[model samples]
Target chain A: MSVKIEVGAGGIPHNRILIYGLVGSLVLIYLTYLNTYFQTEYFAFFGGLAAVAALIWGTDTIKHLCSYGLGTGVPSAGMIALGSGVIAALFGATTGIFAPIVTIVIAAIIGAVAGIMANHVVRMDIPVMIVSLIELAIVGAMTVLGLAAMACGTFEFLGMITGTVSFLGFTVQTYETSVIGGSIIAVIFMLGAIAIQHSFNACLGPGEQQDRTLMLAAECGFLSMIPVAIISFAFIGTYAALVALVISIVGWFYTYRKYIVLSKRDAYAWLDAKPILEPKGGA
Target chain B: MEEIVFGIGITALAGALATVAGAAEDTESDIGSQGDPNSQVQLAPQMGYIHRIFNKAVAGEPPAYGLWVALGAGLAWAFMAMQINPILAIVLGSALAVFVQGVYATTAYLGRTASLAKFGQPVYIDILKSMTTVTMAHAFVAIFTTVAMCHLIISALGHPFPLPLLGLVWGIALGAAGSATGNPFYGKERQYQEQKFGAGVPISASGNIVRYAEAGQRNSLDNGFFSAKLGGPASGICFGLIVFFELWRTVVFEELNIWGPIVVGVVVILIFAIIDRYIEVWARKNFGPYTAPEEASS
Candidate 1:
């Protein structure tokens, strides 16, 4: 019956950002991010914000990640994984080579671990994002303190201060390399994680596609990073990499469209089966 | 902590009552009692109770499992594998929450007229259908809340709610409350069906499995044909109420972190469990077959 089907509000438009505004905000965040004191204080704050966002959203989302019937939350697990992994890798690298590696690894581990909790928080969209914003405020407070410590340098508070120093220890060149290199590795590990997912179906089935997807993604990253690792290649300019990144993202977008859209279960089912015996023109 | 456990305890107790009511009923009228092929349990009455309990269970499932301090929240975590929101990517995600009904009813298409309509293939296939269930940010928050809550609970270990422990404890407590006591909606659909139709076990009629499709239109009621037909909405409603109450209290008064009130979740759940039991006893004994289905409606 028509009564069974219901339309929920879902078509919130993605406002096309003005190029000027988009670039301006990026400038602001980057400037803020790179400031020694700001970096010290705000990285954790931003990290906190990301944490909160992930937590609230994770509640309902985990349900989908786990089983069916219980509604899944929004933002989706794949998005969560990318955002968290990137954010953690971004922040943890601030301290040291070890810090970035450790942090990214930890974040990835947490991302996977949090996958278990995705089903918990259920409202899905705004609530989860709001939580992340609140966490940002909390982390901001922590960042403020860290900056003051960085300025003083004498104020040692356990390994955190030293860790912060180690974070700053990387030369700008190494910073770029590690951030770029380390992120690539983090991506690799994330791909491996499907084998460890909690979803019942994922567990029950062969999971071969997921495995293949992971491999393809890893190869993509590996290829992309080859240019970055070359000492001479370092001079290629950020604008170039950014262009490549955009192209890659667009390419993947189309690929996803074809893979996910054109090849839907329903569509394939439609094409695969023998056509029903048609009734004669006025039977 | 207490609230979540109490909530689940109550829902399970509700589930138990649904089961007990059936077990207590006279077998002749109920299908289980008839034990014959021609006999079918009267659909309407049992559906009513099942509807009521299931609604409570769905909304309440989260809070009940609060004690476990499980679940991680956030955006990044969701996309750790596939970057896009799998739901939008898949489109099938829209089916979440309503999926049980969909799956439950989908099986009915397999009814006796055409047994091998290739139903078995789809049965397993349906589970893979994705829902826009979670996202990167959601996973982040969940992880943060869950870990933070665990840290808070384990760190203090002794006292109730501490600021550090708020997300973990209260989140769990509230989640469990919603899951267990808020309504029978969490996973109590089966229990609801069992309690109502359970009295007359179908000869071969699948219990709630087939009921998903058969669940409508015996009597016209205010809500709609399925209002009497569909009952799980109550679970959503109860969940709404619990969410309303919790958010109202916290958002308005800022008790989001204060722990003493957390014990209420636990205590209240326990109380609810005891009451649900009492309600069942009263319904079966005093109400004179109030909870049972018509033929089974002793």
Candidate 2:
């Protein structure tokens, strides 16, 4: 006999929740655009919020896809998401002001093809594989863009790749920057990949619940932002970088507390112990 | 024209190296009994079937390989910046990465087994002593090939991205290919050989894996022998084609315009999508679904 179990069986419909995440993240990611008009790095932390929103959506997508007997696909999906997304993001970040939107389009195309390959060639046979992959791919792109913005305070290709000074039409000198030259994008790649994937993997089980998983996802998103924010000190002023750090820590703390409470509610028993093992009746 | 030829040559070399890396990756994972199927190994102890399996899943293959290849490429990049010979730098970097992989394998196995001690799962020292070096040997091969491929892309192809970033991307792809194309053989065929072929694992059989060997007791080393025959080669082909096609499009069409490669990529994807649909339909028609218990009895 075979049985099927829904991840968030009785809660709000996942589609509705997905909409909330999609709209919320898209809006938050645009906050980086404010930097253009204001010409400041104060709004950089909004990129971190965008990352958190995308991870929430990614967690739900992973849950939906893995429900179809894809016990191994969870991590594979995340990795493929970032792998394709990285390529798309590199192309998109080159475009000014429209980087986020362009990234979504390219990532969608890449992810759709991958999903088709998995379903038909790899024969995964999950019904939602195509759509879920599209969503994860978009989420992966947003996470990378968000963290890269947080790290460099801008996603401009020139800003990320080098530190150069220009006078009207003449180039003065060029120096190495941390984002690509120092290989910090590599850090962002792993950070976003692990943060998006680990939340669901850690919370998955028969008794898994939606609220706890989402909260942990949010916490992980913020936790990942901390490193990027710290790295931003190399690109932006200390004061601006500190603002991003404070926001990340605060967000992380709030979500972490909520996750712990939800875990307690769902767990059959809770034991906060030192060693967590003791002599039993027989022993 | 000369540039095109050089690019094509580099693409073929990258594909070949990717093939080697992909094959070695699956072999290493099979030897360690990692991935989704490792769940069965974890369950065996609780189900009163303790055997000698190396449970070395510190992380998923993609992320784990990304770290290993990135670390190696990063070290190689550093060494190259210091005017060291590129080939020697890659070799030294891969050696250091192998050390890291070895340490992680040792710790993961020891930590997991110790936690399962309450289940009467004794630590098999002989298996641990023998298998760690074996896994490291395969890890070195995988890491070396992957880093060399990254170097080829950067130096020969003049890719804009640095070595570490390229390493991270290709490493993840190699692991993804192995996970998608190769793992089924290890998880389904080898792990559950007693089950009827093509009948997917039933819900009732979760965690009840085969524990006894043909001689005494099964181990991860035994699983490797079976997976190497099919899984490794399949993964190699899968990753090789991915790298080959990706580079081929860029090399052949980039001169026309930036959108040239994009168009070619779309066409390639459409081609694969069509082929995949054919394969899926063929398999379904030929194999059919698993026979139900009630149907079998009737």
The estimated TM-scores of all candidates read 0.33, 0.58
Among the numbered candidates, top DockQ falls to 2
Off by over 4 Å in 2: A1-180, A184-283, B293-298
Task: Provide the lDDT at B214 for model 1.
Answer: 42
Tens-place lDDT digits, model 2, residues A164-252: 33357664444444467758678677767766776666555555677777777787788777656755765666789899989987887
Docking quality tier of model 2:
incorrect
For candidate 2, the TM-score is: 0.58
True contacts kept of each: 0.00, 0.08
* Model 1 DockQ, alpha carbons vs. true complex: 0.03
Cα-based lDDT for every prediction: 0.27, 0.76
TM-score of 1: 0.33
lDDT comparing candidate 1 with the true structure? 0.27
What TM-score applies to chain A of candidate 2?
0.89
**Tens digit of lDDT per residue, candidate 2, span B180-293?**
888889988888776667666776566567666888677778888877889999998999999999999999899999999999999999999999999999988898865665
Chain A accuracy as TM-score for every candidate: 0.28, 0.89
